[model samples]
Target: MGLIVQKYGGTSVADAQRIQAVAHRIAQRYQQGDQLVVVVSAMGNTTDRLIQLAYQVSPEPEARELDLLLSTGEVVSCTLLAMALRAIGVPAVALTGAQAGIGTDARYGRARILRVDPSRILSHLREGKVAVVAGFQGITEEMDITTLGRGGSDTTAVALAAALKAQRCEIYTDVEGIYTADPRVVPEARKLERISYEEMLELASQGARVMHNRAVELGWVYKVPIYVASSFTEAPGTLICLQEGESMEQRNKVVGIAHDTDVGRITIRGVPDRPGIAAAIFTPLAEAGISVDTIVQNASVERLTDLTFTVAKADLRKAVEMVRHVAQEIGAKEVLWDDVMAKVSIVGSGMQSVPGYAATMFRALYQAGINIELITTSEIRITCLIDASRVEEAVRALHRAFQLEEG
Candidate 1:
């Protein structure tokens, strides 16, 4: 029998009843003779609650100690899940990320997986035991505990799937599948039967929360087929993999729409458009670990240009402070920022080769009376910045414009 790696999100095992339900599902899979390795996130809002508690103790908890505290939530879930399985007469074992051989670099809050040994997992599978591993965390070379950033559990699951060479990796979450747009926003949205890795990565990075981009990238690198579905139901979900032999025409069509409302736009106006000016403005933010997104620079006039970019709204304060300091240092006229912004994106493969796609998107937003602030595009994706309040309207408008509901 082939091996399978299954990952359940926080909502899947939020309580005793939910935990028991997931355990029963895994027990059935084990009874069917598949060697199983299950990964689980902290139950429900456990991680968030832990973070809140940590901050209650200290306004700014040390990253290393915060990771040490956050890692306990997953351990609680994994152990409870193992107990649930054993209660139902199935043999199972719970292992922490370190015990399961997940090794990473020394970064505390957003550590990347360097390697996974899989020796302990192999031993459990050999002993006819189901391995229930904690997700979202690993140990550094120095043996310090580290937590991966948001959506890190998805990364943990895909990394394990690659290491074990599982037949398929299943990601269980709150949503039934990947939809053309956020179903809550676009009621007419349709779920995609399958999506290419490139398209999925773009969607994930753009704003789709069905899975993390890092996990999708890892799966693409290893050529692992990932299945996304709801843990509450058995309905068929979306499959993310290479679309072998798909025609060029088929690849050019828009596949999905993604939007992010947690965006802040900053404009550094009248800066000397000299060499390394961009570097000087951004390097400090990068050093501060503040990610900048959707950058646009206007044409230089008389050796001066306006540079605008977006960052996560949560990082707006720090980003503005750092940019203002840089602006003063570089003799820029002023720094301006707006926190009430959103980014709407459409993604597909080979979209750049197709004509009229960009025009269609802009026309739809314009017709809806949404003002576009900035625009950026990739070979397979196009993104527009607009008012946060109009994001839903813009998403629905673009969804109708692209005719994504037909499929």
Candidate 2:
């Protein structure tokens, strides 16, 4: 029998009924003689509730203690799931990330996985027990508990799959599968049957929430096939693999539209343009773990230019604070930021080899009266920053422009 790794999101096992349903699903697979290892997130909004409770106790909790507190949410779900499986006569055991041998660097809130020793999991699997592991967390070198950042559970599952050499990694979530665009935003957006790793990577990075970008990156690096489908449905789902078939190749140049409303733009106005200026402004943010995206520097007029970049809305304040001192040190006029910005992107693998995709995207946005504030491009994707209020309009317009509905 082949070994399989599966991950259930918080929504997939949100409550008692949902947990039981997931147990039954796992039982069916177990009965078929496949070795199963399941990774699960904290149930429903438990993580959020825990964070709220922590803040109530203290305005700013210590990161190590906060991680220790946050890690319990997944443990609670993991134990409950194990109990459910046992009640149903399915052999099962729960393991926390550390107990399961997930080791990480001590980054606290955003720890990175360093290694996974699957001996404990393998021993349990050999005994015909299903290993239900807590996702999104691990132990540091010093044995302190650490939680992976948002969507860290996905990273956990993929890492385990890679380490265990599982046949495939199945990610069961609330949505049916990966779609041409967010179905809620574009009514006619179609679900793709398959997508290449490169394409999916671009889509995930560009803000398609079906899969986390880090998980996709791990899957790509490990060459692990990932299946994304709904936990509540039997409908056909999407397979993320290394390549698409000839039939899929016949589709339009643009395969999907990805949009993120979590965008915040920062503009350091009237900075003296010179060597090392960009580095001076961005280096501190990097060291602070604030990711800067889509940087644009206006052509210098009289050796002065406006430099702009985007960061996650949640990190906007911290990013501004981190850069303000540097901006002044570099002789800048003012540091300005806008949190009401959003990004929309069109992604496909072969778009760079062809012409006219960018023009079509720009024309569609222009026609919809959505002004493009900034632009960026990769080999396979084009992203535009726009007013957050018009993000839906821009997505719909781009989807129709590229005719993704018919994919």
Candidate 3:
């Protein structure tokens, strides 16, 4: 058997018992004669607790310092996992991101992986040892520690799989697999047996929590297969792949519903409708490393228009401050923002060729009496920004409208 790369989320190895269980699972693969490389996240809520502690000490902790503090969470988990495996008579060694030769650009909390020099990891595997790695944290050229924002562990696992040419990358989490809708939000939502990289990417971007979009992109680019399953169960899970075959039925079906509540909207009112105006308003935001989503610009009336867009709710304060400066720089009337809105979206690859997908989605929301504040669309995704309070209702309605329940 070839090498296999496996990643366990925080919940899978939340404590000593769970760590021991995961170690046994890895031992099974090793005993079967397969080389294994394992990636582990922090224990449950450890990262959150560290962030809370940082804030308790400082009003605004420095990004570089925060990265240094948060990286310890994964290191602790990795070392403990290695210890667990060794105690059970399996050869194992834990390595930090730097120790594994995972190099990334210097972006602090949301750094991007520039390259992965897997010589150290390969060496460990060649020694017939399970190489345990600390995920989500990497070293930059400046030798500063950086965290890969949210869901970085998943990225690490896939990147290693691609670099090592592993047989497969398995992501073990709390859930069985990706579903049409969040199981908590829609009781009728069904787990998918397989999903395409394109569809998974759309759902991940729109707010599916099972996998991160960045990780999916890495898998797609490397043409690596990813399997998602629950660490505690033996049941077969979903496989995210290039395609499920060329079937017309699969081409035009609504695959999933994704929603995001951690969003904030901003509107720049009374801005001049000029060629460079849009770029001028958004350039500063990009420079500040703020990601903008779902942008809408009203048609000019009397040579003025309003530009509205969305950002992560956590960045609302910083975004507002930056936009306010741009508003004045462009001589706009004023800048207004709202953090009480959430985005709900339905994604399917078949949407591009299928008419009425948008209409059906709109009709479902209309029947539910949910007012849509903003709307955006891609070939396979239709997203509506609605009052945050109505998101659950909207998701339920859409899930029912699409008939996503298992037969």
Candidate 4:
């Protein structure tokens, strides 16, 4: 008589057969005496396709109307999934985010969760029915519908798990789990049995698209145990939880190497090393909603310094324009921008207070003849920007440097 929240991404229930298969899985779990709450995303590529259709119709889509159009993708998924469950003799009902009382702020596109009243969901649960709720979309305090940001469904699932006090939140995805290096980057990379929420957050922020940062942040805040497994393969996947003293925490000194290909670098060369220059340079990019990561300011001269910051490649053009304004405002000699940079990070909590770890990473990359454009370090991670084409090579070198080859 416990509650469990399971969220399946679009790929999991993309087709009719997959929906029926998911229904069977949920029914088996439901009949086993658990009050099951399911959160589902839109069908596979549905959201993307919708965006394409919208763009074809109109070049620039308004945010409010776009949310209204985008929110329908999840509705189709939830209802169909519910129907599949019912056909198999399972008492299941699909509810939109609003119908289930998932309330959020009126932020239009990327609204944050305000609260969730599970009265309707609980009613279905008490009546021996599985409550299936659409993920990502929510209702505002003013009773208007809003869509959560990208990967919002994962956030929705984690939020619901926390609200329901479910035993665990399972996030089924396309990959088996987090790996020592992206399997595509390093074919010999090994899957992690476990990773701390902190490391997971850093990884997600760095580049792991399997779990969203907002969802991981919620999980950390709520102390919710999260599992990421494959939807197609019945592989034993990864668990993300506390730092250590857990059954799955690894004994290795290094955890994983994360590489991102969609990162660009902007170097503000020869700026006067004034106190407010860094802030002045980054403020515009921040205001544009462009996330800046791994900033480095070259050692100052008598009064001159070069500062660099990382932003997503997709925002390269806008960020460049912002930097141009910042340069003119701050009196920088030159504004250098490169969209061909990739970021590679080595993340593990053990690295804190562990000497020479960063040195070892640098040596490995050096041995591979991969040029490092910029280096950034934290208490628990080391990140570097290199040529985009060498991203995979950098990851492989780091993975081997850490000896993460699978047995």
Candidate 5:
């Protein structure tokens, strides 16, 4: 019998009925003789509701306490799931991230997994018990509770799979599978049967929500195969693995289009363009854990230049404050930011080897009358920041331009 690791998102076990349904699915797998380890997120909007409750009591909650509060949501779901499994006559036990041997650095809201001992989980498995793990959280070196950021459950599952040397990691979520584009945005978007790890990494990083980017990164590094499918359906799902020796001519040059509406752009206008200026402004944001994306610097006119970058909208206030402080120190003019920005990207491994992908993407956006505020590219992706209002249009235009629907 092979060992398997599975992760269920918040939606899959949102309530009593859903939790029971998931238990049945696990029971079936267990009955088939495969040892199972399950990782689960907080139920439904439990994390959000908890955050709201915390803010109601305090404007800025303490990070350690907030993490401790947030971690309970997953614990509740996991225990309920364990009880459900036992009710169905399946041997099961609930374990928190720490009990499951997940250790992390003390980053509080965004901790990174440092190690997984897996001894406790292995004991449960040996006893013919399913180990139900609370995902998204772990213990710090100091024994304080810490949580990985949003979608951290995915990381937890993949990390466990890697440590346990499971045959495969299955991620059960609300969506049927990974699509050419978000089907809600593009009606004709097709589901991909398989995708390369590199392609999936780019898609997830570019804002595809089906899989967490960090999880994909871990899966790639460990060479672990991940299966993504819906928890509510029996439909065929997508397999993310290494690229096979297939005819290059048979593959689509553009694998998918990803868009993010949670974009915030910051422009530091009239900055003195000089060595160490960019570092001076961006170093503090990095130390503050604010992720900056799609930076653009205009040519210096009279030794003065404009520097622009994008961050998540939720981070706009803190990012701007940090930049403004740096701006004054660097003798800059004004710090400006726009919260209503969106980015749409086209991603495929073969795009860089082809000549016309960029021109095609730009032409499509131009034809759709979407103003391109800024542009960025990697070896396999091209991202354009545009007015949030025009994001859907931009995605559809690019999807059609890349002919993704035909697949």
Candidate 6:
């Protein structure tokens, strides 16, 4: 039987009773003759509470000290989970990320998993012990505890799966699985039984939040099978994998629509459309670590062009300042910032060869009474910047237009 690596979110094992429930589920899987490795996040709200505590002590807490502070959250979960499994008569061992040999870069926050040794894990498995690892954390080269950014637990799980060459990596979250669109917005959106990794990457990047985009990219690179399932239900979740040789050729024509509500548009007005002007305007924003999406440039007249792009609302100020600075230096007239934007995207492995997909998307949005502010397209995704208030309605309309849900 193939070994499986499963990662549970904070909500999955939040309290003592919840931990006991997880133990029962794990024990059943253990009885199935499959060796198991479990990764877990901190208990619900624990990390936030820890951060709050740190802030109570100091408003500008040192990063290194903060990492030290936050790492304890997962340690508590791992130890408790191990105890719960043992109480259920299963032999299990809890390990910190360092103990599990999760080696990452020296970055304090948002560090990337560079490698996994897992010798300690293998030893435990050989001794007939299940191994539980703390997720979203790793030890740096300097032996410093570093925290991965948001949804880092998913990356931790996927990284371990790649390391151990496990049969598949299961991400246990609060949601059932990948949907045509977020079910909260599009209630009729169906859970995708199987989704291509590329499509999932687009979905995550567009604010799925169920999984992080970097984790999906790593899975794609490592050819690891990822299963996204709900922790609270028996419903089967979505399996994300590489398409077969031929499936790649036909799968991307039209897939699913993804939408994000946290978008703000920045327009750099009256900028000279000259060499390095666009670069100058965007370079500082890039330096400030903002993810810009849906970039558009209107036709330049004489020498000036209007440039626009979307960045996360959280980073709106930083992005605005950076661009405004560049605009001043370039003698541009003004910088316009619009925070009322949302992104609606359709991603599929099947769109490579499809013609008129753009027209199809436009016609659907038109019928839905949605106005598109900015438009961007790639080989597999067609995205639009629309009014943030209408994001859900636009997503539902697109989901229906693409027939992404079952009848």
Model 6 Cα lDDT, one tens digit per residue, 24-109: 88898899987899999999999999989999999899988998889899999999999999988999999999999999887676
Off by over 4 Å in 4: 246-252
Candidate 4 lDDT tens digits, 1-407: 57989999998989999998888888888878888999999999999999899999999998778888989999999999999999989999999999988999887778889998888888898898988899999998777889998889999999999988889999988899988778886888889888889889888888878799899999999999999998788899999897666432343367777878888888888898878887887777776678788788888888888888888787888998888887888788988888888889998876867678889999999999999888887777888989999888888888888887853
Q: What is the TM-score of each candidate against the true structure?
A: 0.98, 0.98, 0.98, 0.94, 0.98, 0.94
Per residue, candidate 2 scores C-alpha lDDT tens digits across 280-396 of 888889888888878888999999999999999889999989889898799999999989989999998777778899999999999999999999999889999999999999999
Q: Model 2 — which ten-residue stretch has the worst lDDT?
A: 244-253
**At residue 177, what lDDT does model 3 achieve?**
94
lDDT of 6 at 214: 84
Weakest 10 consecutive residues of candidate 6 by summed lDDT: 246-255
Error of 4 at 373 (Å): 0.8
Regions more than 4 Å wrong, model 5: none
Q: Check candidate 4 and list the clashing pairs.
A: none
Q: What are the RMSDs of all candidates, in order?
A: 1.0, 1.3, 1.1, 2.1, 1.1, 2.0
lDDT of each: 0.94, 0.93, 0.94, 0.86, 0.94, 0.87
List runs of model 1 lying over 4 Å from the truth.
none
Please report how far candidate 5 places residue 279 from its true position, in Å.
1.4
How well does model 2 score by local distance difference test?
Answer: 0.93
Using TM-score as the yardstick, the better of models 1 and 2 is 1
In candidate 6, which residue pairs get closer than 3 Å at backbone N, Cα or C atoms, i.e. clash?
251-349, 251-350, 252-349, 252-350, 252-351, 253-350, 253-351
lDDT of 6: 0.87
Can you tell me which runs of candidate 6 are displaced by over 4 Å? Answer: 245-253
